[model samples]
Target: MSPTPQERRAARHQFGTGSDTPAARRGPSGGRKKPITVDAIVDTAFGIVEREGYEALTMRRVANALETGPSSLYAHVVNKEDLDELLIGRLCAEIDLPEPDPACWRQQIVSVCTQLRDQYLRYPGISQAAFAAAPSSVDTLRVGEGLLAILIAGGIEPQPAAWAVDSLSLYVNAYSLEVSLANRRISGSDDNWVVSRGELLRRFAALPETFPHTKRHAAELTAGTVRDRFDFTIGLLIDGLPGARRQP
Candidate 1:
């Protein structure tokens, strides 16, 4: 069944994609005030993105959510890119990085990366917004700066610490996106959506012999919690950063 408008609204909330504000009126003329804030529009845009994927996100849908016209939305938001930047900024605000600890910089990096992953999962469509942009907003830069400070404090040189911040952000964003997309596909499908690890292995077994490595390690591939996957990727990334120092 297609989701009802209320269901869609709730889904938006679950995804942390947008917020719905009470409508306001101007003067004695209760016809229509400029009925949208940049926050509201972006929040509604996020709702649209969560309901429909990024490719389907549109100003028209966002306006519909806010019960306003697209033209009004354009007054606050320029285009998809502008809206995306706003959404990314909103997502960045959710993360609160702690002080860089020189003694446990590796653990600190892992924690920051985990927080980024959790935030993206909480706000499903955010990765699509943050994908292309470098960290520019205060929150985004603050996270980057903390990561860099931790890495440098752990004895990494300046350039490599900077590079690690960029590299780490890219990995966290990209991997979380991949996981989110896969999850949506699984959850939204009606046919046999809840596959067990063994069932997944059976399905893999049915595939062609060309994917030899996949077949060989099918058990290991599907062998753990999403938390496990997150931790594994984080461990691998953190383990590799020390090597980045050699590149001068």
Candidate 2:
């Protein structure tokens, strides 16, 4: 069965994805009002991104959505950077916390990475914040901690495990950012994606004549869907980890 709306809201709060607004905000009529809150501000920011696209998300846009001035938002939100970090934390928290299974660390890593990508993609342009402020958030640190523990349990040294977490998280964040931008440009999945993809391929195939190799195997270069590419990249990292395992 589908979750009740209230249940979903509860989950968001638990995951830091939604705010507990202090009651409904009153319209300009002033009969009743929900005080503008940090959570509400973040929620409004997400709504603006969903409607106008991620690039259009800003404190002013959120203020406009909430029917308040941008300065009012400052009362709840420090600035755009702070808002981005909160967004990142919310996205990261949405991922299922991985269990450190000694025998299945590789699978755990892949599972964690895939879940993270799915959640981060829900908020386009937000994962880019991962590069700047994610480490400071509890959610991001939780993911890193789980992965590091699993790495150590699997016979990997502390230093290598640390680097792996850094490298793996970066890879997922960068890949999601690229895909989010591409999705915006494609304007939803349909003929537009096909046409845009075809155009990209055509450019590559056309250049193969000059570059030789590019023309020879353009199809191979663009063979996979986003999911396929993500899985393959993740597989490479997991499969290669043993080579870097520390000597006892």
Candidate 3:
């Protein structure tokens, strides 16, 4: 007789097939298995990224996880680049963008940045995927539209608001990637990073003849947590905004 549902589930689990669902597919043996869908492809891709860093994410890997061939994925995701754009869209589209609040533009901007950062942080190396993606996706456009509305409502000129959004988005993505890379490379021991950071600062300070500015503010420069530094930078960006043209 055929294997019971429980036995089939055990077989799927024993293989590399993911969660028990209709999406599960059987091998050449002709049994109940999940059908591959775009959603399933995306889910499998994320799982691979989480288990192994982004570098290990490939079509074959995801396909293998689904008990299917990589060609099966092509019907959904065209290639690695296409998959990346979809991945970014998948994450970005979920952000709950706030309606433009002229009176609270600054706060809104901060909240948006924080949300985007947290979203990307969940995937560890998602920034790499973001870097490779185009801005054509629905999700990416939504984010841009939301930020633009907020900036425009703040009495900012169109051009500078556009520039600000571009620059600010770039900074947040770049900063998130930098932090993610550091976390992956550093040991769990905080002492190592602390000592290494201090040593680098001291080295700069000792170079007074060659780097006067470095020597002058080493202590001050080293005085903040990562969040403090990020907040200070965000504050600077905010203060410089409301960049409308002055009346001649």
Best by TM-score: 3
User: Model 2, 194-220: lDDT tens per residue?
Assistant: 455578788887673568877777788
Q: Which stretches of model 3 miss by more than 4 angstroms?
A: 1-26, 188-195, 242-248
**Poorest 10 consecutive residues of model 2 by lDDT?**
17-26
Give every collision pair in model 1: 18-43
| Candidate 1 residue runs with Cα over 4 Å from true position | 1-34, 50-56, 190-196, 203-217, 243-248
Clashing pairs in 2: 24-34, 25-33, 25-34, 26-32, 26-33, 208-215
* Model 3 RMSD, rounded to 1 decimal: 9.0
The Cα local distance difference test for each model comes to 0.70, 0.71, 0.72
By summed lDDT, which 10 consecutive residues of candidate 1 come out lowest?
4-13
TM-score of 2: 0.78
lDDT of 3 by residue, 88-118 (tens): 8778778889988777887787888878887
Score candidate 3 by TM-score against the native: 0.80
Q: Which order, best to worst by lDDT?
A: 3, 2, 1
RMSD (CA, Å), each prediction: 9.3, 7.5, 9.0
Best by lDDT: 3
Better of 1 and 2 by lDDT: 2
